[model samples]
Target chain A: MPDTLSEATRSEFDRDTSVRLREPGVHDADLSPGWAIGHALNGGYLLAVLGRALGKTLPHPDPFTVTAHYLSATAAGPAVVRSETARAGRTLSTGTASLFQTGADGEEAERIRVLATYGDLGALGDDVRTSAKPPIMPPREQCFSAQDYPAGPDATPEISKRLDLRLDPATCGWAVGAPSGRGEMRGWLGLADGRDADPLSLLMAVDALPPTAFELGLSGWVPTVELTVHVRARPAPGPLRVCVTTANLAGGFLEEDVQIWDSADRLVTQSRQLARAKLD
Target chain B: MPDTLSEATRSEFDRDTSVRLREPGVHDADLSPGWAIGHALNGGYLLAVLGRALGKTLPHPDPFTVTAHYLSATAAGPAVVRSETARAGRTLSTGTASLFQTGADGEEAERIRVLATYGDLGALGDDVRTSAKPPIMPPREQCFSAQDYPAGPDATPEISKRLDLRLDPATCGWAVGAPSGRGEMRGWLGLADGRDADPLSLLMAVDALPPTAFELGLSGWVPTVELTVHVRARPAPGPLRVCVTTANLAGGFLEEDVQIWDSADRLVTQSRQLARAKLD
Candidate 1:
């Protein structure tokens, strides 16, 4: 088992092994609030997991863009799910994943839909343009430790797990440090070793922003309702800074639009997420 | 110029001989408050113009769907613009239009982006499914006219120009029978001619919802900042209704969500808009 798993990058996480392409089921411990006891799982977390799964399916040395929006919230158990590549064309390939979960009362609680497109840059003509440059920031070695931002006692085990994170004063990055029994979480993220550049490496860095920003205020309280993200472009790995400019809060919804720029001052990628807010 | 004008089928509008595929270059009369001026002329009216132009380019009997979203507010004048087809397949074609407005001071005030898709139903392989199924309503001959509703002076001009609308008792359908020359106004709308069918036809009946629902009860009125709309399915034309569900107001900004449904109990499209709120 250990020999076969080495192909997947090793996560900083110690307790929970990084999910493998062969793994078909998610642990029950990952289910968080807004999730019925009988609920299937978190949609946002599922999206991330599926992203990881689909990312593995793409050919190596490929660049792809994955975008997802919630059609309806779904819960866990009994309902079936299947992921398939509809058209894996020579230049561009498309993949879809569908998740279905049934409730305790026999009603369907959720449905998750994902569409991913993988592309080979070499095959296309050059038409490259970026709106803004990526920002430069502090290195991971210079940042503070995870203990300083401890997850509260009541914090879902899914979130309390440690993460190796570093911020470019302007951008946020992190890598999974420990197994989070909880379904999903966000916080400072970065690599312990400093190596970067791959999509997974960037995602490991980008996904940490939400938890980190919210934690700055809560210190321990509050949880997210849902998280929706889009990657507009990819940034280079280096001593870069990212700035999270605006966080719009209205009604019971919160939306954050963040942009990451590489050290070259070229705009890298833009990301936005919507989450239900809770005052702790 | 006199010979180019022709009576439209409804006898209420004049069809110009010169199709306007671009934004208006000349100044229009100053518009009143509460009126969706850009929408009336650009999004809705201008589309008719584009259809006329495209009609000249393509063969007759070309079925297409036009979707427009206001990127910024505009004033009367020549706006640099361009149109291009992003994708042109045998069965499906997508076109995008961009408009840029330069003010008297040579400052650009607004940029408008529109995307439209043209399709031939006969091409798709035996798969045509429409989700909306609104209930039937009484004929136009039996329904009461806007003469029965309260009218505001500035609302007369727009109110007078009405469309055929019908709504089931559960939903709200709005239209202005005779719009006055200025400010915001409202009146119930449904089957002006009292035609009944599934919700698909009803989809074509209603344009965007008015901004009145969000401004009601506020000390100051609100002006639109920007508006976006999407038509998921073409619903039948009758008994349609709209109910203003909720509005988020803060920091002088307002966002409203409206739900439209047909007589048959199917929830149709949901409309949303954003605007700046101010005191009347």
Candidate 2:
């Protein structure tokens, strides 16, 4: 691992996404309240908890790609992840997981369904070289920090308090109810607790910022229906630059596309998620 | 149902994506040669096959979104789809499937893994409206049809025979060794069997075009590693406009983004896929 794998990265992230084996294919996890927006937990954090179960059950060590479907919003608490391997190839292993939680109706509800593939990413491919250009943004110091956002009563969304997320001030109009109508968001993201982000934590980073559609006048936390994440190269621990943009928002449905550039300025991750949000 | 659901749509599509229920969660499907490209079945067509199994095993009527990870390429032959429903509620249903085929080593191999959600699309949203702009292209009459491409020894790709896929002539340089290096493809798509395209067929349509990276001078078929399709609305029966583009290609990997516009000029389907291809 890179020297940047600080003690904080290991302990804090493990605390956030760690899972304990219950049976051969089942694991138990505690969804931390520190990762919730309002009452619902972040979708990417949920996927990481599920990823932990899959990463342990499968033969591979790193996740190559993962797709998660949010069946229903889940609250933070004890959850069970039922994971099973679908394929165990020489270099790649595939698995499916479902996180179940007890609902208000006293029913065991499966909150999220995830399909992921794992592999030894180091041996997967060559060095990074991309024709894509990095997202343009002001210096981190000049950007509007989510931490400093004026919180009226809600206590700065518990989730934001856990991350060092700085949004481009030009794109921060939505926070003030003056949306720019541009379906995009650019930010610098890292763990506020000094935990460096690894490939697994980058899963959470993809969704760390406010929804890009929020800039288009959509309010509240737009629920993600389905999200697909592709991890190309693991980042050398540090803050990751992120760009989230959307082109289609029709009939209260839209898709958000994300790109995460590592400290070396190479594209390291990409994701597209379908979500539900209403216009202002 | 729309009058566009002609007998051809029902019969031809059923023949192509049909799955015979073997049990509650298992289905047997015949891999159709008509849907193969140089013996490798088209990724979108394969996704349609998996969607067929999940659509039947689950309670819902329409597939809202599906993400498929292509583990290994399978040739045309007998295959089994082992599908299991993870969640089945009133409004939505989720399921996972593995399409297994006999490999050259005489062992059954899981060719692909698919995760999908189903719901009643008709009741899902409102009328058509979009902020996305349709892809620019010349009139259909001036474009180059995949069927008319010059065949060298091998018959025109078997899969192209199955659809009326037209490519914008300006972007066709990749076909004759003079690539445009733009990494984009614009075209019109429709079923050659005269079958109308519904929301289900849009799954296949998303991956129906030649890999857009071809314009960037990448040769041969770019194998898709993972593909996610979001179906926003049921498309009307007609030739659909499609735009396929990629901005990031590094470490021998790239992500393709596609948008499909319906007859009414409304965005109907969107997809993002990670594929592997080598530059010439």
Candidate 3:
């Protein structure tokens, strides 16, 4: 959509272009290209918009944690974000942000409701330290490009041009008739423009992978009902390793847990979401 | 506190006593005896109160998902709950609730911000069903009561009388000088009064376990910054099994994931929280 890949990535994240401050604690955000799952805009993309607004209104510079409830599906357009500071403490601040759109009757209807906590991750200090090993992944040269997957007739071109993903063959069995028999997906994710990953990009990357339930032989549109993202740390400058796992899929509902590790092999973000499973 | 363990358990969950309706969409709740970690009340206990209020206001009878941001520590006293319906869909509803308390200046101040999703768990249907097996635990007779651990001079008696916990010896290394190389705490949890486990109790049980970081030799008040609970199903009447594990602890912070299983061997709830690591 933009002249260069870097420009496109920057445009996607540029608050001035994507989110325009209309007034104090209120803003208008543009739902641009490439951040969509089918026709509806991606949930994480919306979260990033709301998070940016919350970050500006709150005292904190980074979004430590954000939980968004998808009220209704929204298409590409201009949306309004209204944020309120629920609590402002010395170390942490909590608030609520509601993303709305104009209805046919000229009334504002909410499409996404967000609750978030913001703080300076670096300022928290490091007295205790321990970390689990990152998920083992094959070298980028050996992995298959997710971009190579045959696009459906209705597939949007912006998706492939926006996100660069290399899938781990072992967990890509869903592509063929042979399912993995396990609910998991592994891939390497980076902005197509080769931009460095940040807290906001980490939020978008958590939902970039295909639904892990697809590996369990469940198909169709799996719309998320609620999603929660925990920003563990800022990412180093490089592609991020991604892993998505599902522990349970029952009663037409499933939960997906996503883990993102920066190039430095440090865990940067973790998220879990509950979505309605569309089964054949 | 209530004369007997049964009475105490009932009192903790008695909506009429703990939650008093002040007006439409407004409620006053009490943070009472035995639910405190020290001077501040337990995060899960506060969640149960807010969840109960949200469950009453939303059309959905069950709280399928809830995420709360702890802005500041709350003490034992009366707090007000204000709830707003963000979206009222046909099958699911999203809402926000803020718990507030009177400050020294006699002004209402927010303590906790909650984002929740409510729906009819039963009505969701059972077309596609799968579940991860519950964690392996010894019989109740073989496990040791958490109460057996000698309390410090500051230990609150209400914690012991409110919850009956039988620790899994394998993960209970923190009780002694030996620390589990891995950050984890496993045990069986139930109401001391022997009430049947439900969604509300399940919410409380998720946070009832001691911080898993303790097993990693990190001690002190590991307060949660944010907590999210996903109610998978209705418990089948009995003691619930619990497992708390931490995958990463860095930058003076860690994330704990909690899993709960009902007596009938069903995974009733799963939760994840980000908390500050209080190391010695």
Candidate 4:
């Protein structure tokens, strides 16, 4: 019994973000190094974990579109995922995956719920192509490390260590108490561990940037009510350039749009999320 | 037995768009009067039906955020809905609902899959409020009926009858064989059935507008890959003022953002979707 228990713990700790199917429709995942904003795990990290689980259950290999609703803040630890196939078609497959934290009584408490679509982008051939100019920014060598800025009042220091973000100085006005008078933020994003940018990493990049609402003179925790991401193309091997913008802020709600361009200058991922402003 | 079967058929034909739950986690719905584009049922109408089913399964009555991925074009017929509760929190509940068409062999073929979040929007309390000006548009009386324009090569007449749309003439350049040079469409929208605008109606309204890509001189069917709608508030009882805009159209893909305002001039729903441009 002791040997079996030790083996299970070692396996859980080894693959923190990877999905391992424990049985059909059930998965075991570990959230290590624990990306958190205060005590709550980062929403994107939880999404990536769930995405991996959904991808495994579907026939396709790429998650072309994914949407998540954060039911509650989750703590970092061993989590369980249960996925069910909603539809399986010739070109696309859709499903839902739920993440849970087990209690001492063996009860599972839900954290985040996601709906995702998996497809083969290559199968959906691109028949029409036009160039939408990417956002302009200084070269990577000229940008400043985003780590220099202090964490948000609700953020933890581990965020900087988990994701390496370098900001365009001109758009970093919010860091110095001066906003650009526009809700926008541009930066270069990559994993701090120097891993290649994949679909999961791009998901994290979509929410990793500083909230665009911060530039509108708003502060504190801006919780995302819902987030939707569209993966256009597989990213090339390099840092991704990201631009986040919010055009409307009203009714205590704001919508943030993010565009991620790969090193090859190809638009890889596009995401938009609606969130509530935590203002006193 | 004959009378029972006849009564079921009458009930199914009478309320095609209304949601009627047959049991916990299961629902019986019809697709009569079939909201169709040529032969396929409209995606938004399907979403509304699925959203209604999910709302019934959750503790909350309002579905504030809903997303749908159209797996395959569906036909008008009897359908079954299976909903699973993913998370039932104190303030919000997230779940998945799958719609299927029952075949002659009693096989259920999945048609549409949805992820939805239900909450007590009124209970959330309006603590923060700021106004964002609604889109600029000519009065409803001044705008022309979109029906006068010929349906797109890919559009069907059912769209015209499903929603009464009045377009701002200046933005309808495509209707007269001229490109607007900008990716935008502004108009007023309301149900053809004259039903009051509720949260479910607003979900349909988000996708009711003409494809913004048409204004950019792109023609044919621009199919939505995925759509995400965020319900900010319960809309007032009147035609909704709407604006749909796309800033980037590249590589056969475009993202459209929509803002919906009610009769009281308050922003009620915001939506964003990614779609493929079927240019000839």
| Tens digit of per-residue lDDT, candidate 4, span B92-138 | 77788888987668887777778887877676555434345788889
For model 3, residues A73-147, the per-residue Cα lDDT tens digits are 776777889998887878778888888988879888789888888889878654435456788889877776755
Could you tell me how far off, in angstroms, the CA of residue B54 lies in candidate 1 after the best superposition?
A: 28
lDDT of model 4 at position A218: 82
Q: What is the Cα-based lDDT of residue A186 in candidate 2?
A: 91
Judge the docking of candidate 3 as incorrect, acceptable, medium or high: medium
Off by over 4 Å in 1: A1-4, A7-9, A12-46, A55-63, A70-81, A86-90, A100-111, A121-131, A136-145, A150-162, A167-188, A192-197, A201-204, A211-242, A262-267, B1-280
Please give, for every candidate in the order listed, the TM-score of chain B alone compared with the true chain B: 0.52, 0.92, 0.91, 0.88
Q: Interface RMSD for each candidate model?
A: 17.9, 2.3, 2.2, 3.7
Compose the digit string of candidate 1's lDDT tens values, residues B186-208.
22345333444222222223343
Model 2 ranges with Cα > 4 A deviation: A1-11, A102-108, A127-129, A152-154, B1-11, B102-108, B127-129, B152-154
TM-score rank order: 3, 2, 4, 1
Candidate scoring better on TM-score of 1 and 2? 2
Best by TM-score: 3
Worst 10 residues of 2 chain A by lDDT: A1-10
TM-score, first chain, each model: 0.57, 0.93, 0.91, 0.88
Candidate 4, CAPRI quality class derived from DockQ: acceptable
Kindly list the per-residue Cα lDDT of model 3 for residues B1-280, writing each as its tens digit.
Answer: 2312354346445532256677888877777856877677878888998888777778888889999998777778888889888888898888888889898999887888889999888786655455578788788878868556756434534565677788888887877778887888898888776677788777788899888887888668899899999998888887889999998887777899998888877777889999887656
DockQ of 1: 0.02
Deviation (Å) of A79 in candidate 3? 1.0
- Stretches > 4 Å off in candidate 3: A1-12, A15-17, A124-128, A151-157, B1-12, B15-17, B127-131, B151-157
Q: TM-score for every candidate vs. truth?
A: 0.39, 0.92, 0.93, 0.86
For A189-269, candidate 1 gives per-residue lDDT tens digits of: 434444453454443334444343342232232233322233323445554344553222322233344444555454343
Segments in model 4 whose C-alpha atoms lie over 4 Å from true places: A1-16, A122-133, A138-142, A150-156, A170-174, A177-182, A248-252, B1-16, B124-133, B150-156, B177-182, B216-218, B248-253
